[model samples]
Target: MHSSTLFITLTTALGLVSAAPTDKTYNPTKTSAASRTTHTVIAGRGGRLIFDPDNVVAEVGSIVEFHFNPLNHSVVESSFDTPCQPKDADSFFSGFFPVREGQSDEVFQIEVKDTRPIWFYCAQNNNAHCQSGMTGVINQNFDRQEFSLRAHKELAAEVEGPSGVQGGIQGGWRIPNPNPLGGF
Candidate 1:
């Protein structure tokens, strides 16, 4: 009888131990990467007239939120080789979001598809904007210092016009006065 009771107790204990959850079974961070994440970027700020962080590294499921300042500005996708010209296929334009004084705010959100590097510039009416080195990059493979040097050296011509391809912003994203008479 004693031997039987001891065996039963040992078997129950073993069953409970085997059913217990393991410490490594659940990892929030591993699964959280696919969860949506928002990253903010200033189109132009502090009178410097540049993307606050001209270079960014975004994961596959991240969103890049661009906030335009008081100054008239726009975000248009371009390529590294052709820094100024818009690559029609991969192009996205945020039109020219002019926030009036005392107005709320407008943001352009772009979702990341992959690790491919994305280059953009301000395609304002005045060509000087892009020429003045108003360019930004996302998911950049190279270092920030190296990307900036390349942006300054490469960005020469301004885009002929915005490609009229509006991307980055999902359907839920609303823009105040979205379709201006002659804007993207």
Candidate 2:
């Protein structure tokens, strides 16, 4: 009888261990309000094919908001090795945002899930924006000088064409621009 009791206890403990959540699971709602920060990144502002403040160091649970300016542009996630191509099908992408003047009514935002670097670029091929040096990075590893944003941009210059997903992916969010006039 004692052996049976011990067996049951071990089984229950094993079940609990198996049910434990892993680091891969992220629940945005559970993140503390005080720990959350919003980093603004302007896209193609002032008719320039660039992401103002192109390099940002954002913590996990923080949001990187990409505000689109006049003309059309998009933000697509890519890996450091492949600068202009989408990192994967699950990568985050902000579908093209076109504005005649001023800024777009919407903004693209992605939450930082980990400290690893995230490379992105504008997939606007009409003017070859990505090839022209429209790229940005999030949480870049400063210690690795060889894998810097400048190097990524250089690699992007060599790409024949930059490509992106059909539309926005699951890893990003597109919400109404809080400041359409470029305030704050």
- Computed on alpha carbons, the lDDT of every model, listed in order, comes to 0.66, 0.85
Residue-by-residue lDDT tens digits, candidate 2, 1-184:
6998888788897884355677796657665547679999999877898999899999899999999887888898999998778888888888888888888899999999999999998888642898899999999999999999999999988888436555544578899998866652
After superposing candidate 1 on the true structure, give the runs of residues whose Cα lies further than 4 Å from its correct spot: 1-34, 102-104, 143-153, 157-184
**Which candidate ranks first by TM-score, i.e. highest?**
2
- TM-score of decoy 2: 0.78
Measured with C-alpha atoms, the lDDT of residue 171 in candidate 2 is 75
Clashes in model 2: which pairs? none
lDDT, candidate 1, 1-184, per-residue tens? 6998888788897884355576777546654334688776776676556787887888887888777776677787877766666657547777677765422266777788889888887766455677777877887776555555365436445444433334453222445433223121
